[model samples]
Target chain A: MYESNRKSSIVNIYLGSMKIAYVLPMTWACGGISAPLSQVNALSTRGHDITVFAPKDGRIDWFPLAAPVQVHCEHPVEEYFDAVVYVGDTFAQHPFSSAGQKFLLLQGKDHLWTAPAKRNELLQGYSDPQYHILVVSGWLADFVHGKCGNPRISIIGNGIDINRFFPAPAPREKFRLLLEGNFPDRNKNVIAAIEIAGRVRQHFPVEVWAMARRFTSAGELVDRVFLDPPSDEIPGIYQQCDALIKTSILEGFGLPHLEAMACGCIPITYASGGVMDFCKHGENSLIAGVGNLPSLLGHVLHFLSDSDLRSQLKDGALATAKLYPWNRVADALERAFAGGIEGKS
Target chain B: MRILAFTRESYPSNYPTSYILMHQSMALEELGHEVHYYQQDKHPLGLTDYLNSFSFDLIFLDLEFLRSNPLLRILSQYRRIEPIHIVGALYSLPAPPGPAWEVVDFTITPWKGETTSGLAAQFDLRYLPLAYSDRLHKRQSASAGSIFVGNTTGNKHKEAGVYLDELIGERSVFCIGPEFTEKYMDPFMLGSLYASSRCLPNFHYSWEKSGDCILNERFWQTARCGIPVNDYSPLMDEVFETGLLEHFCFADTRIWQNRIRNLNSGAETVHPALIQKLDDSLKEHSYKDRMKQLLDWLR
Candidate 1:
């Protein structure tokens, strides 16, 4: 079984745990904030002394964490951390003084910055000699290398909680397609999924289902749209749907697709570079080129016609999900931390 | 040659005209030519001032931006001062009569219709079809299916009845129209989409079907992807190998239905000769090829 193999793999890479502190971003019900929180939970389970530093007003209420969250507004934390990993671009802006190996986790590109100067500032921080650059995907590694001219970078992929997300035993009455992510985000490309749904509806009696933080005019197109469902209820939503249509053009590490795969929901996705970290086209999931809505529609149609393919891909999805337990992600992070310690010596 | 190219579409747009500007500019640059891209809306300097700043050998203007009075005045002024060649691309057909045409030296049009060519003959218009960027639109190894990738918002889908859902009934026809998002697909993404599908069901506007040799960019784009383009255009006979286009060409909704069924059933397979011809056609129809021809004409 892959679950046992995944656990063994994690055990094999078990370096002695040390005091690891993760600097958090302002919290929202998004993956950017959740990925680190989930990783911190996994690391604590591995017997690491973990302390989460958060902005004073930042709400860490999206999910429960195993580690104690230290709220630092303007005040500096006087505690010593063995390895402090700074998340997001503002690591330079809010310098937390700590006696430890520092890492700037470059999760995504400077997407919020419209100006070239802001982008250059972010690139400068990536190339900073003090912090070891760690990224979530191979795309980011290439980005930092190409832009920042920093060759030495570690890529630790995001993880899925196999226990939290799993396939349901019962099947739905009607064939349904699940769409994820918020509508306002341009990078998410939610419109592409809606258009594909509109096209697919012409062929079969299918329903469009979506779960998002909020809804816009496009939300009306979905047959059943749930606004910000609890994290525990996400698995049920994924289980009911046959496929998850992810149309994001840019993603550091698209966790929802992975989470959907864990629930035996075949990820019919665009080849948004981050999803490539897990998804193999025609293997575990169907991947088309980003913005290629027709090819993505083709995938959905293929699922409808070919029952054998559906079964095969469902099996492949489950098998792929088993390989990425949170323990493995924790192991990768620990290895990255160990490498930093060895380099210092 | 130092050429000044005019574009109206913003970067990262879904507009076909934007792609034309980008592909042509890229081709011209690759051909060891200096191309200064100028957008009238975005440029800080005025049109006349921008023209004065750069010593351009030629000014390639998209015909839509050809303002009648002011543009003619600027061109007229430049003509007296310097021998600057003014070539304009008529992206859309039925070239309107204007005073701007008086100062224009040559006109380039992608349309091959009687109206377009007749106007071209009347005003020395060249019958140059739109080309695909080989740098972007090339086939990669992938699992294939029948697909249609173009804007459905236009009259083409409406007049031909290709826009209806029944056309895609029970078959794996991938339909992607970015018009829903008010954006155009990225060129690299479009190339990958072309490569993903085994064949593309290309439809043209109803007006384009009437003895008009309006071979849209999809013909070359999908062909460059090394896939069979099941086009509804009768103009394919004038461009591609005869027997080849007959196999891929659909005349009506009934024929389109049969072709789709055949393709889905795996009864229809693109022949080796068809693929070889497609590969050969791509060599002559790339943006670089078009740019080379344009430059040769200037010489």
Candidate 2:
């Protein structure tokens, strides 16, 4: 009788642990989806047993799990997970009827211009009152709420690891400007940056460092372009740069902007999409109008000529970075889950 | 009658085949037919059991699966029991002989015209037109610019990279396919090239291989954004009217360049009308209605 009671107690304790299932499309590689990996890491640390349900061959870290939880391949299976967080639109049609709580974390709507059928499924499927939608930016949240009619949507800005990206002492001599993106195709507005850099170089000694895997020869217009060598050195590059510029046509959330700011580098970015949610013009980062070469160049020049402005922006950026620490973000996520689960109950 | 539609399972990355099957199944259910989905991984259908189970009124099988599986032989065994609808990229590919002769009742090919009759003779097929879900219809009504859809890599024979590189330089081109692999291709570079234009090209394609058909969804959504599509397949014309899409035929450099120029310049083109005609023909014989008709014929 005592043995049976002990076994029952152990089973109850095992069952009591909150089982959270995360469904991410791909692994971290500097795209919009990569921004959430830090949060996933933070959430895992909080004792909320987490299992990431993703593609069998995806590069996501599965070793962090305490014990082997059910990581079912490519199918919706009934599990004891208390919450399911889907990181992309691929799981938009996934049946959440079995899960305790369903949440969608959208980084960006990549195929929004196309794939109406999939978008409709996502919008309709998530419209269920039981599901909670969390977007990285207000634009994304508003779009989802308005299009899908889901009232429980929340805008949870992406959090960065402040420790990984905290400010380094300003480098002496030639001002270093870093531009990093996984895909630095025409849209990183790399060409425009190059053009602006060229204009700025005539006045000041400017050196541009680009961290990207796929850099077209066409982008050779820039003087000092560096291709991404490996993943480990990304933090070092961020630490070395004086300012980071993100001129993408649109971003779900600019992680590099936050990462650069965390490292105490001044951020010069376009005022668009999720960047506006955090980057206030002249406060934390210099905001330039999208695709405006003159304005983008103007921001770059202001930081280059005025050391005091750069110093102020650096301080402001590092200060702002504190607000979006991974710990705080994880706590907010836990709160969201608690509120959602409690409300549903 | 109860029907079971099967495809690959859902994942975080969007797979186009899964999307297509979901829409088709939903459409079938909406037409007052019972539909159940048996995914590849969830509950894999073995040949004998799949043939024996519940006696479905109809079964729609993706051609890619037929190529990959030995189930086609089992399908041939029960060719007389009920209607089997074969859907997917069926352009001169080797499939099981028995199923080709007797198992497949009707075939839905992405390619158009008497191409159906040829496929029928070889695989005992009947041509069926493609149809989009109501979701696509709504997206089309709201679209603003041209949405170009195609993979960076061409199918087994064609080279999509060559055409894609040239096309990327000129117009706003968004890519939807598998994730960017170093060995395979980079989807992000493709996306950035497309998003470079004033129009914020959204990259919403799933890198997941769940087998959902995102092509149709992308077509309608692109249309919703008022983005005319510069697609590679002739099949798109059949599913969406010429009024809905801007079609492009793949060819060598010079021909492709001319077509791109004509499309960009908004010149009078026969391609648009041809697509519209194809759409009109398909509208008259919708895939859902046709599938029902074929099943009834078998009954």
Rate residue A242 of model 2 by lDDT: 87
TM-score of each: 0.60, 0.49
lDDT of 1 by residue, B211-246 (tens): 566777777787777465455665577567776667
Question: Which residue pairs overlap in candidate 1's backbone?
Answer: B14-B184, B120-B125
Best by DockQ: 1
- Against the hidden true structure, what lDDT does model 2 obtain? 0.55
lDDT for B222 (candidate 2): 31
Can you write out model 2's per-residue Cα lDDT over B1-299, one digit (the tens) per residue?
55555556521123445544555554564465545444555332344443343345566666666654356666665654545543333433333444443445555653334544455576645444444444223212222223344342222223445444455556533334432222221221222223332221222222211222223334333333332333334455445554444343232445555554554455734444454453443443333664565466556
Which 10 residues in a row give candidate 1 chain B its minimum summed lDDT?
B179-188
Candidate 1: docking tier: incorrect
Residue A50, candidate 2: alpha-carbon lDDT: 79
